[model samples]
Target: MEISTRRLKLLAILGYFLTGITGGVIIYGSEKMIVATKTPILIFMVWSGLVLVIVSLIGIYGVIKINFGYTVLSSFALVVVSITLINHLMYAIIKDRSEVESDRKVLKLWNRHMLMGRAMHKIQDRLDCCGIYGFQDYILNDKQVPVSCVSEELVSYIYKQLGCKEASLREYLFSRNFIIFSEFTSLLLNMITAVAGFKLCSRIDRGI
Candidate 1:
């Protein structure tokens, strides 16, 4: 019985450590886009990571104290985390699927929406990319290529030849894959933590 308790405690601690790492991964994946895009999904991703870390901390504390109430709370928190992660995962998949189709739409709306234009400029500047497909996108659209497309040196060779479309898409795909990986990892850990938590709660209740 003592051995079982020790094992359960160890499992909970390990889960907590992994969960913290998973949360950090998710946060790191989305942090940059949060300010640039101001998208709700990115904000939610950040919040989800924070919540997971907090819940894992609570779970670790519960396991250490052998407190049934805290253990139960942690189990419930896992359910919430699972739901959020599922939602986040689905959104990411959908966005990934539609990304190619959305390129033209983005280009069309580039000059129309002030917010989108600023966001595109920011992305171009940060990625050292030009218009959607290339600088020719501006030419084709009869629009002037912004200064963001070029380096400070203003040399022709230094000008960004890559398009913001490809650059941003590549970045988004990488972030999406990273977040998906973290979410799956977190969900798996959540299950382990939930099972271990419940069993520990039961053992504590039985005074074992």
Candidate 2:
């Protein structure tokens, strides 16, 4: 069986629509991460994601309505957002690559944002980790490691483990990479549908 051009165009449009929705959800959903960390970098990332999400929704609406002008504008916006997402993701990956540096960064964030410190303590209790790099992080910062780092098995005993920086960094990088991948995929999907829309609009212009 062969698919008609119209059918293919419809399929592409649906794909783009779904991709936009997915990207929007991911981008908007990152608010939780931002609240947990409350770092300037995170604020910027979430802001970018929010912008991408809004643009994606615009594209989705335009494609669904088959509006040539709206589709053209939204596709252009998507291209710019995709490039920005990729660039920020790359910069974050590089900045977060080192555990020691990540720990230092986290400490600075915690100092500037008291809420971040509380969140870090909560994370330590849940993950059974110490400070960012270890107990030494607390010492260097002139703060004592929270009791949350103590093992349940030996509450009375002080047990020190690897700092939460490694795990936090790992989770952060994974989220960044996921966003990057999603944005890249969304870009391709938008391109495909945008091209189809352009061709369709051209045909209408030619009265074919």
Superposed model 2: Cα runs more than 4 Å off = 1-5, 35-45, 89-101, 109-128, 135-145, 150-160
User: What stretches of model 1 exceed 4 Å from their correct place?
Assistant: 1-3, 35-40, 87-91, 94-96, 100-105, 112-119, 139-144, 152-156
Candidate 2 pairs with clashing backbones: none
Could you tell me how far off, in angstroms, the CA of residue 76 lies in candidate 2 after the best superposition?
A: 2.3
lDDT of 2 by residue, 103-155 (tens): 66566645653444564666665446677667677778766666776667855
In order, what lDDT does every prediction score?
0.74, 0.61
Backbone N/Cα/C clashes per model? 0, 0
| lDDT tens per residue, model 1, 1-208 | 3447889879877887788778887777689765434355667878988888888888888888888898889878987788878887887887665365336535654665234445467667766777777877767866666778776665766567887667666665666676778789899998888877787888889998
What's the true lDDT of residue 27 in model 1? 77
Best candidate according to TM-score? 1
Q: Clashing pairs in model 1?
A: none
State in Å the error of residue 4, model 2. 5.3
